[model samples]
Target: MVELRRDPVVERWITIPRERAASIEGLFPGKQEVSRGACPFCPTAMHEREIYSIKDDQGRWSVLVVPDLRPILEMEGTLERRAKGIYDGMSGVGAHEIVIETREHNQSWATMAADQLGLVLRAYRDRSSQLRGDKRFRAIFMAKNYGGMASRFSHPHSHVLALPIVPRTLVEEVQGSEDYFQYKERCVWCDVKEQELAKSERTVALTDRFLVHTPYASRYPFELNVMPFRHVADFASSTDEEIADLGGCLRTTFEIVKNRLHDPSYSMIIHSVPLRNASEHSYHWHIEIRPQLTSLAGFEWGTGFFTNPIPPEVAAQHLRG
Candidate 1:
């Protein structure tokens, strides 16, 4: 069983899953394990269940989507929103799925072919679209925790979390974008993309349809945002051609980061409009990649402001080289 609890002061929802602690303990068995023979993501190993899959020309599954063995949120329960005193809570009723990127244990997104990466992106779009029909879910968050201290599993994979409520960070972003639109009558991300393209110092990689650049005020050293050149609010609405183009740009950017940073640990988050508010013109969809090179300290935790040691310009230069 799981529940969504609200923070009284901040009004943020926190997922309180009963089995999370035990699940996390089971994720990492021991620190000394280095062999890939015991990996569960391998093609030979057993999986819980396949929710979605994509096969290659030879009829072998190249990409697979499976339900998490120890999912934080269960899909079988009702929300059952209730209040206790001043606090509000609800059942953690959502979907948690994993996208197994490859059948081979050694392959990674950075090194994978563009076509294969495109198939993975297609899986994400299909899964999100399918989950959007459920009115209970407010948002679907797709994220990848790769390498370094950020990743618990060594296998290359990503997670899709269909959340009952929009996350605090996403709420803040939508609010900020809406405010900017009301003031300027334009999308904030479009303006940012335009400015970054005009000033190519922060631009790391670009394709005909997409642009990959370090944001003007990046929160981390090598933080990169991948956005379509055209103004688009929903990632699931992307065309097949657009998805392939995006795959190329994303793969190129990842290759650059890996080559420059010696394959650092990083997290990639897909930011998009909520399911209910699908027609939001003020907001634009993008992927934020944050390299786990820096750690948060007291000042960062106390204050919401992040201190980045490497400037965006320097980081962009390193990637461009």
Candidate 2:
């Protein structure tokens, strides 16, 4: 077996090419939105603020949760449907909550300690359970968009979306995972872990409880998968210990990357079981982290194939070193 640091097959592989990167427009130039970003998410003094906040014993605010100012899916109060020329679209009716992870404007996930990240993860699970029970809600997804282009706000935060429809990505994952589960009579993600380990080509980082690898066919560049080696299926179902450990893994990975690579911006999203009719063992929970260093253009969107510049193995070696 090749050493963990320098696996030949893994190195010099195409992670996403330069032209491919250039192909994705509006990817670079780094999110020209929200000039001079400030602390607009701070807790207010009115019930009309529609924001909830947690504070430390010193009365200093720790975290803030508020409805998104520019909501993609704000509550319409009721669902009324109409049609356009040849397409059908509903009113943007969903909950978009901005989770202000910390008060520090400059600090981000990479700089956050494991304990701090754990608290944020707990907030996600807590909100997921609360939102999933809503009759109008169908799914709750936790996502973070870093850098200027990815989000309007620059602080370390994530969004908990309570969507009425199961997202297309969730639908696809269900179909793909379920098919593999039935055929192999085992969790496909578990099998994936084994395969990635055996291949050892994309492994980024491993800890006592977690393993981070680049997907064999990564949809995006610098895509890192953080999975619980024990095959936990739901992010909401994780224990406190697991959350803490996962947070540790997150912190370590980000710290290493920040130290090794100059890249500071990225996006992270969790792939967990759906809110309704979920087969616990049929799926596995994981997080995908992709740095905001590439763009997606027509060829990628048209052809449905993403080109990454830096190979996973090389990225991993650099990260591990």
Candidate 1, residue 120: CA error in Å? 0.4
lDDT, model 1, position 115: 89
lDDT of 1: 0.88
Please give, for residues 191-304, the per-residue lDDT of candidate 2 as tens digits.
989898888778887877788987777776667899998876678888888888888888888887677767557778888887775667788888888877777888898887
Candidate lDDT (C-alpha), each: 0.88, 0.72
* TM-score of every model versus the real structure: 0.94, 0.82
Model 1 weakest 10-residue run by lDDT: 26-35
Q: Given candidate 1, what's the lDDT at residue 307?
A: 91
Global lDDT of model 2: 0.72
TM-score of 1: 0.94
